[model samples]
Target: MEKLEQEMPLDPFEHIIFDYFPVYVEADVEAFLDLTSDQEKKKCTLEIVHAGMKRAAQAFNWDLQILEKVYHTIKQTGYKSIFALLKKSSPNKKYVCSIMCHHEVKRMDVYVEIKKRSGIVVKKEKLFSVKNTDEQDLLSEYGTLTWTLNHKVEFADKDYKKVYRLTFLEKDKPEDLVWKMERYEL
Candidate 1:
Protein backbone atom coordinates (compact mmCIF):
# COMPACT_ATOMS: atom_id res chain seq x y z
CA MET A 1 0.00 0.00 0.00
CA GLU A 2 1.20 3.51 -0.84
CA LYS A 3 1.88 5.91 2.05
CA LEU A 4 -0.31 9.00 2.32
CA GLU A 5 0.77 12.49 3.31
CA GLN A 6 -1.29 14.90 5.37
CA GLU A 7 -1.05 18.69 5.32
CA MET A 8 -0.27 20.53 8.53
CA PRO A 9 -2.34 23.39 9.87
CA LEU A 10 -1.00 26.90 9.26
CA ASP A 11 0.25 29.18 12.01
CA PRO A 12 -1.59 32.43 12.66
CA PHE A 13 1.53 34.60 12.97
CA GLU A 14 3.28 33.04 10.00
CA HIS A 15 2.85 36.28 8.08
CA ILE A 16 3.36 38.82 10.86
CA ILE A 17 3.96 42.38 9.80
CA PHE A 18 7.55 43.67 9.86
CA ASP A 19 7.45 46.87 7.90
CA TYR A 20 5.26 49.52 6.29
CA PHE A 21 3.36 46.95 4.29
CA PRO A 22 -0.20 47.71 5.33
CA VAL A 23 -1.95 45.24 3.03
CA TYR A 24 0.05 42.28 4.27
CA VAL A 25 -0.24 43.55 7.82
CA GLU A 26 -3.98 43.87 7.51
CA ALA A 27 -4.17 40.38 6.07
CA ASP A 28 -2.08 39.10 8.96
CA VAL A 29 -4.41 40.91 11.34
CA GLU A 30 -7.40 39.20 9.75
CA ALA A 31 -5.71 35.84 9.85
CA PHE A 32 -4.80 36.34 13.48
CA LEU A 33 -8.36 37.23 14.33
CA ASP A 34 -9.68 34.20 12.50
CA LEU A 35 -7.29 31.73 14.08
CA THR A 36 -7.12 33.02 17.64
CA SER A 37 -9.45 31.96 20.42
CA ASP A 38 -12.01 34.53 21.50
CA GLN A 39 -10.51 34.83 24.97
CA GLU A 40 -7.10 35.89 23.64
CA LYS A 41 -8.14 37.72 20.48
CA LYS A 42 -8.37 41.23 21.90
CA LYS A 43 -5.00 41.20 23.62
CA CYS A 44 -3.27 39.55 20.68
CA THR A 45 -4.77 42.03 18.28
CA LEU A 46 -3.44 45.01 20.24
CA GLU A 47 0.04 43.52 20.48
CA ILE A 48 0.19 42.69 16.80
CA VAL A 49 -0.99 46.15 15.84
CA HIS A 50 1.59 47.80 18.08
CA ALA A 51 4.39 45.66 16.69
CA GLY A 52 3.31 46.38 13.14
CA MET A 53 3.14 50.11 13.79
CA LYS A 54 6.61 50.12 15.35
CA ARG A 55 8.04 48.34 12.35
CA ALA A 56 6.23 50.69 10.02
CA ALA A 57 7.66 53.73 11.80
CA GLN A 58 11.17 52.39 11.49
CA ALA A 59 10.73 51.48 7.85
CA PHE A 60 9.24 54.87 6.97
CA ASN A 61 11.84 56.91 8.90
CA TRP A 62 9.15 58.40 11.07
CA ASP A 63 9.85 59.83 14.50
CA LEU A 64 9.34 57.34 17.32
CA GLN A 65 7.62 60.07 19.31
CA ILE A 66 4.87 60.14 16.71
CA LEU A 67 3.92 56.61 17.66
CA GLU A 68 3.32 57.68 21.22
CA LYS A 69 1.24 60.59 20.02
CA VAL A 70 -0.78 58.27 17.83
CA TYR A 71 -1.48 55.91 20.69
CA HIS A 72 -2.45 58.81 22.92
CA THR A 73 -4.85 60.04 20.30
CA ILE A 74 -6.40 56.63 20.03
CA LYS A 75 -6.81 56.37 23.77
CA GLN A 76 -8.31 59.82 24.08
CA THR A 77 -10.61 59.79 21.09
CA GLY A 78 -11.27 56.12 20.73
CA TYR A 79 -10.97 54.32 17.41
CA LYS A 80 -13.55 56.39 15.66
CA SER A 81 -11.18 56.81 12.75
CA ILE A 82 -8.11 54.91 11.64
CA PHE A 83 -5.88 55.57 8.67
CA ALA A 84 -2.69 54.46 7.01
CA LEU A 85 -0.58 56.77 4.92
CA LEU A 86 1.99 55.63 2.40
CA LYS A 87 4.38 57.76 0.42
CA LYS A 88 5.92 56.94 -2.93
CA SER A 89 9.13 58.83 -3.30
CA SER A 90 10.64 60.00 -6.55
CA PRO A 91 13.48 62.33 -7.39
CA ASN A 92 11.31 65.09 -8.82
CA LYS A 93 7.80 64.07 -7.89
CA LYS A 94 6.01 62.63 -4.87
CA TYR A 95 2.77 60.73 -4.51
CA VAL A 96 0.74 59.63 -1.52
CA CYS A 97 -1.91 57.04 -0.85
CA SER A 98 -4.17 57.13 2.17
CA ILE A 99 -6.62 54.52 3.38
CA MET A 100 -9.09 55.80 5.94
CA CYS A 101 -11.70 53.87 7.88
CA HIS A 102 -14.51 55.62 9.71
CA HIS A 103 -15.94 53.37 12.35
CA GLU A 104 -18.77 55.74 13.21
CA VAL A 105 -20.36 55.12 9.82
CA LYS A 106 -18.62 51.84 9.09
CA ARG A 107 -17.10 53.17 5.91
CA MET A 108 -13.65 53.05 4.39
CA ASP A 109 -12.18 55.28 1.71
CA VAL A 110 -9.07 55.09 -0.44
CA TYR A 111 -7.34 58.09 -1.96
CA VAL A 112 -4.28 58.52 -4.14
CA GLU A 113 -2.85 61.92 -4.89
CA ILE A 114 0.20 63.82 -6.03
CA LYS A 115 1.64 66.25 -3.52
CA LYS A 116 4.19 69.01 -3.54
CA ARG A 117 7.26 68.88 -1.36
CA SER A 118 5.59 71.41 0.93
CA GLY A 119 2.71 68.98 1.52
CA ILE A 120 0.21 70.64 -0.79
CA VAL A 121 -2.06 68.35 -2.71
CA VAL A 122 -1.58 68.95 -6.44
CA LYS A 123 -4.20 66.50 -7.65
CA LYS A 124 -6.22 63.79 -6.00
CA GLU A 125 -8.55 60.96 -6.82
CA LYS A 126 -10.80 58.77 -4.73
CA LEU A 127 -9.84 55.24 -5.69
CA PHE A 128 -12.72 53.45 -4.03
CA SER A 129 -15.03 53.15 -1.02
CA VAL A 130 -16.52 50.39 1.06
CA LYS A 131 -19.72 51.32 2.81
CA ASN A 132 -22.55 50.18 5.08
CA THR A 133 -20.76 47.61 7.21
CA ASP A 134 -18.18 47.30 9.94
CA GLU A 135 -14.83 45.90 8.88
CA GLN A 136 -15.02 43.00 11.29
CA ASP A 137 -18.32 41.81 9.88
CA LEU A 138 -17.69 38.59 7.99
CA LEU A 139 -20.25 39.64 5.41
CA SER A 140 -18.72 43.08 4.94
CA GLU A 141 -16.88 43.61 1.69
CA TYR A 142 -13.56 45.41 2.00
CA GLY A 143 -10.24 45.59 0.23
CA THR A 144 -6.70 46.94 0.34
CA LEU A 145 -4.31 48.46 -2.16
CA THR A 146 -0.60 47.83 -2.43
CA TRP A 147 1.95 49.87 -4.33
CA THR A 148 4.26 47.70 -6.38
CA LEU A 149 7.89 48.42 -7.13
CA ASN A 150 7.15 48.59 -10.83
CA HIS A 151 4.97 51.71 -10.42
CA LYS A 152 1.68 49.88 -10.37
CA VAL A 153 -0.94 49.29 -7.70
CA GLU A 154 -2.60 46.01 -6.78
CA PHE A 155 -5.94 45.63 -5.04
CA ALA A 156 -7.04 42.70 -2.94
CA ASP A 157 -10.66 42.15 -2.05
CA LYS A 158 -11.77 40.39 1.12
CA ASP A 159 -14.23 38.11 -0.63
CA TYR A 160 -12.30 35.04 -1.73
CA LYS A 161 -9.17 37.14 -1.13
CA LYS A 162 -8.91 37.81 -4.84
CA VAL A 163 -6.04 40.03 -6.04
CA TYR A 164 -6.29 42.44 -8.93
CA ARG A 165 -3.43 44.21 -10.63
CA LEU A 166 -4.29 47.82 -11.38
CA THR A 167 -2.81 49.25 -14.53
CA PHE A 168 -2.83 52.98 -15.18
CA LEU A 169 -3.16 53.37 -18.92
CA GLU A 170 -2.93 57.15 -19.07
CA LYS A 171 -0.49 59.23 -17.08
CA ASP A 172 -2.81 62.20 -16.85
CA LYS A 173 -6.01 60.32 -16.15
CA PRO A 174 -6.47 58.41 -12.91
CA GLU A 175 -9.84 57.02 -13.97
CA ASP A 176 -8.35 55.50 -17.10
CA LEU A 177 -7.09 52.44 -15.30
CA VAL A 178 -7.86 48.78 -15.69
CA TRP A 179 -8.22 46.00 -13.15
CA LYS A 180 -7.16 42.52 -14.12
CA MET A 181 -8.42 40.33 -11.30
CA GLU A 182 -6.84 36.92 -10.94
CA ARG A 183 -8.40 34.33 -8.71
CA TYR A 184 -6.33 31.83 -6.80
CA GLU A 185 -6.19 30.36 -3.32
CA LEU A 186 -4.30 32.35 -0.71
Candidate 2:
Protein backbone atom coordinates (compact mmCIF):
# COMPACT_ATOMS: atom_id res chain seq x y z
CA MET A 1 0.00 0.00 0.00
CA GLU A 2 2.82 2.40 0.83
CA LYS A 3 4.45 1.80 -2.51
CA LEU A 4 1.18 2.47 -4.28
CA GLU A 5 0.63 5.72 -2.43
CA GLN A 6 4.14 6.91 -3.20
CA GLU A 7 3.67 6.32 -6.91
CA MET A 8 0.84 8.81 -7.25
CA PRO A 9 1.80 12.39 -8.18
CA LEU A 10 -0.96 14.24 -6.39
CA ASP A 11 -0.68 17.76 -5.09
CA PRO A 12 -0.01 17.63 -1.39
CA PHE A 13 -2.27 20.59 -0.62
CA GLU A 14 -5.20 19.59 -2.79
CA HIS A 15 -8.22 18.14 -1.07
CA ILE A 16 -9.04 14.57 -2.13
CA ILE A 17 -12.53 13.18 -1.99
CA PHE A 18 -13.33 9.47 -1.61
CA ASP A 19 -16.44 7.33 -1.59
CA TYR A 20 -16.95 4.40 0.85
CA PHE A 21 -19.38 1.54 0.45
CA PRO A 22 -20.03 -1.85 2.02
CA VAL A 23 -20.19 -5.09 0.03
CA TYR A 24 -22.87 -7.66 0.80
CA VAL A 25 -22.41 -11.33 -0.04
CA GLU A 26 -24.06 -14.66 0.69
CA ALA A 27 -22.82 -18.25 0.53
CA ASP A 28 -25.26 -21.07 0.02
CA VAL A 29 -24.26 -24.64 0.81
CA GLU A 30 -26.43 -27.62 -0.02
CA ALA A 31 -24.10 -30.47 0.95
CA PHE A 32 -20.58 -31.20 2.01
CA LEU A 33 -19.52 -31.72 -1.61
CA ASP A 34 -20.76 -28.31 -2.66
CA LEU A 35 -18.15 -26.89 -5.04
CA THR A 36 -18.60 -23.34 -3.78
CA SER A 37 -17.00 -23.66 -0.38
CA ASP A 38 -17.84 -21.18 2.36
CA GLN A 39 -14.20 -20.26 2.90
CA GLU A 40 -13.67 -19.60 -0.79
CA LYS A 41 -16.66 -17.27 -0.93
CA LYS A 42 -15.53 -15.41 2.16
CA LYS A 43 -12.02 -14.98 0.78
CA CYS A 44 -13.35 -13.62 -2.47
CA THR A 45 -15.62 -11.15 -0.73
CA LEU A 46 -12.89 -9.92 1.61
CA GLU A 47 -10.44 -9.51 -1.26
CA ILE A 48 -12.87 -7.36 -3.19
CA VAL A 49 -13.56 -5.17 -0.18
CA HIS A 50 -9.90 -4.84 0.74
CA ALA A 51 -8.81 -4.01 -2.79
CA GLY A 52 -11.48 -1.34 -3.08
CA MET A 53 -10.62 0.23 0.25
CA LYS A 54 -6.88 0.16 -0.43
CA ARG A 55 -7.24 1.79 -3.83
CA ALA A 56 -9.54 4.49 -2.49
CA ALA A 57 -7.15 5.25 0.33
CA GLN A 58 -4.28 5.56 -2.09
CA ALA A 59 -6.20 7.81 -4.46
CA PHE A 60 -7.43 10.06 -1.67
CA ASN A 61 -4.07 10.20 0.13
CA TRP A 62 -5.27 8.68 3.38
CA ASP A 63 -2.91 8.41 6.30
CA LEU A 64 -1.33 5.11 7.24
CA GLN A 65 -3.16 5.04 10.55
CA ILE A 66 -6.55 5.54 8.90
CA LEU A 67 -5.86 2.73 6.42
CA GLU A 68 -4.77 0.38 9.21
CA LYS A 69 -7.83 1.15 11.30
CA VAL A 70 -10.22 0.54 8.40
CA TYR A 71 -8.61 -2.82 7.60
CA HIS A 72 -8.68 -3.82 11.25
CA THR A 73 -12.33 -2.93 11.54
CA ILE A 74 -13.23 -5.03 8.50
CA LYS A 75 -11.36 -8.04 9.89
CA GLN A 76 -13.16 -7.69 13.19
CA THR A 77 -16.46 -7.81 11.36
CA GLY A 78 -16.88 -11.29 9.88
CA TYR A 79 -18.53 -9.89 6.70
CA LYS A 80 -22.02 -10.89 7.73
CA SER A 81 -23.52 -9.51 4.49
CA ILE A 82 -25.20 -6.13 4.07
CA PHE A 83 -25.77 -3.62 1.32
CA ALA A 84 -25.02 0.10 1.57
CA LEU A 85 -24.77 3.02 -0.84
CA LEU A 86 -21.45 4.70 -1.40
CA LYS A 87 -20.72 7.33 1.27
CA LYS A 88 -18.72 10.32 0.15
CA SER A 89 -16.12 12.14 2.22
CA SER A 90 -14.11 15.23 1.55
CA PRO A 91 -11.13 14.42 3.74
CA ASN A 92 -8.85 17.38 4.24
CA LYS A 93 -7.55 17.32 7.82
CA LYS A 94 -9.84 15.61 10.31
CA TYR A 95 -12.83 13.45 9.58
CA VAL A 96 -15.02 10.63 10.85
CA CYS A 97 -15.81 7.41 8.96
CA SER A 98 -17.72 4.21 9.65
CA ILE A 99 -16.02 1.11 11.09
CA MET A 100 -17.62 -2.29 10.93
CA CYS A 101 -18.00 -4.77 13.78
CA HIS A 102 -17.46 -8.53 14.08
CA HIS A 103 -20.39 -9.70 16.20
CA GLU A 104 -23.94 -8.88 15.21
CA VAL A 105 -22.64 -7.05 12.18
CA LYS A 106 -25.60 -4.69 11.92
CA ARG A 107 -25.95 -4.06 15.64
CA MET A 108 -22.30 -3.37 16.31
CA ASP A 109 -21.96 -0.29 14.19
CA VAL A 110 -18.99 1.89 15.16
CA TYR A 111 -17.44 5.12 13.93
CA VAL A 112 -13.76 5.96 14.03
CA GLU A 113 -12.55 9.53 14.09
CA ILE A 114 -9.16 10.50 12.75
CA LYS A 115 -7.15 13.62 13.61
CA LYS A 116 -5.42 14.28 10.29
CA ARG A 117 -6.23 14.45 6.62
CA SER A 118 -3.81 13.54 3.84
CA GLY A 119 -6.14 14.65 1.04
CA ILE A 120 -9.40 16.38 0.19
CA VAL A 121 -12.51 15.44 -1.80
CA VAL A 122 -13.83 17.99 -4.28
CA LYS A 123 -17.28 16.59 -5.12
CA LYS A 124 -19.51 13.81 -3.89
CA GLU A 125 -22.57 11.94 -5.16
CA LYS A 126 -24.60 8.77 -4.64
CA LEU A 127 -23.00 7.06 -7.62
CA PHE A 128 -24.27 3.53 -6.93
CA SER A 129 -26.59 1.66 -4.64
CA VAL A 130 -27.25 -2.03 -3.89
CA LYS A 131 -30.98 -2.42 -3.25
CA ASN A 132 -31.71 -6.14 -3.40
CA THR A 133 -30.14 -9.60 -3.10
CA ASP A 134 -29.84 -9.93 -6.87
CA GLU A 135 -27.88 -6.70 -7.14
CA GLN A 136 -25.75 -7.76 -4.20
CA ASP A 137 -24.76 -11.01 -5.89
CA LEU A 138 -24.00 -9.23 -9.13
CA LEU A 139 -21.70 -6.78 -7.32
CA SER A 140 -19.98 -9.59 -5.45
CA GLU A 141 -19.07 -11.32 -8.72
CA TYR A 142 -17.48 -8.49 -10.75
CA GLY A 143 -17.60 -5.83 -8.06
CA THR A 144 -15.45 -3.18 -9.63
CA LEU A 145 -16.54 0.36 -8.68
CA THR A 146 -16.28 2.65 -11.68
CA TRP A 147 -17.60 6.17 -12.30
CA THR A 148 -17.60 8.10 -15.58
CA LEU A 149 -19.03 11.56 -16.15
CA ASN A 150 -18.93 14.18 -18.86
CA HIS A 151 -20.04 17.82 -18.65
CA LYS A 152 -20.01 20.83 -20.94
CA VAL A 153 -20.12 24.50 -20.00
CA GLU A 154 -20.13 27.73 -21.93
CA PHE A 155 -18.59 31.02 -20.76
CA ALA A 156 -18.38 34.17 -22.84
CA ASP A 157 -18.76 32.33 -26.18
CA LYS A 158 -16.14 29.77 -25.19
CA ASP A 159 -16.94 26.10 -24.55
CA TYR A 160 -15.32 23.76 -22.07
CA LYS A 161 -15.59 20.00 -21.84
CA LYS A 162 -14.89 18.01 -18.70
CA VAL A 163 -14.60 14.31 -18.15
CA TYR A 164 -13.83 12.29 -15.04
CA ARG A 165 -13.20 8.59 -14.68
CA LEU A 166 -12.81 6.81 -11.37
CA THR A 167 -12.20 3.08 -11.16
CA PHE A 168 -11.49 0.80 -8.22
CA LEU A 169 -10.46 -2.66 -9.32
CA GLU A 170 -12.39 -5.54 -7.78
CA LYS A 171 -11.81 -8.24 -10.41
CA ASP A 172 -8.17 -7.55 -11.16
CA LYS A 173 -5.01 -7.78 -9.05
CA PRO A 174 -4.12 -4.73 -6.95
CA GLU A 175 -0.67 -4.47 -8.58
CA ASP A 176 -2.22 -3.35 -11.86
CA LEU A 177 -3.78 0.03 -11.00
CA VAL A 178 -4.12 3.12 -13.18
CA TRP A 179 -5.78 6.28 -11.77
CA LYS A 180 -5.37 9.90 -12.82
CA MET A 181 -7.06 13.07 -14.02
CA GLU A 182 -6.47 14.82 -17.34
CA ARG A 183 -7.38 18.30 -18.58
CA TYR A 184 -8.15 19.38 -22.15
CA GLU A 185 -9.09 22.76 -23.63
CA LEU A 186 -11.46 23.07 -26.56
How does residue 72 of candidate 1 score in lDDT? Answer: 66
Q: 160 in model 1: Cα distance from truth in Å?
A: 14
Worst 10 residues of 1 by lDDT: 1-10
lDDT of 2 at 36: 56
User: Judged by lDDT, which candidate is best?
Assistant: 1
Off by over 4 Å in 2: 1-35, 82-131, 134-186
What TM-score do all the candidates reach, one by one? 0.31, 0.27
Give Cα-based local distance difference scores for all models.
Answer: 0.48, 0.35
Please provide, for model 1 over 1-186, each residue's C-alpha lDDT reduced to its tens digit, 9 standing for 90 to 100. Answer: 011122333243566555324422332445554654543443344445665666657656789898978776765674445544444543333444333343333355555554445775545555556665354441234355566644355555565465544333334555554433333446
Instruction: Give the alpha carbon lDDT tens digit for every residue of 1-186 in model 2.
Output: 111122344353455345433322222233323435555455455555565567556666778688778666766776455433222232321322211122221132211211114433222222223233353343243232222221211111112232223322212553563333333433
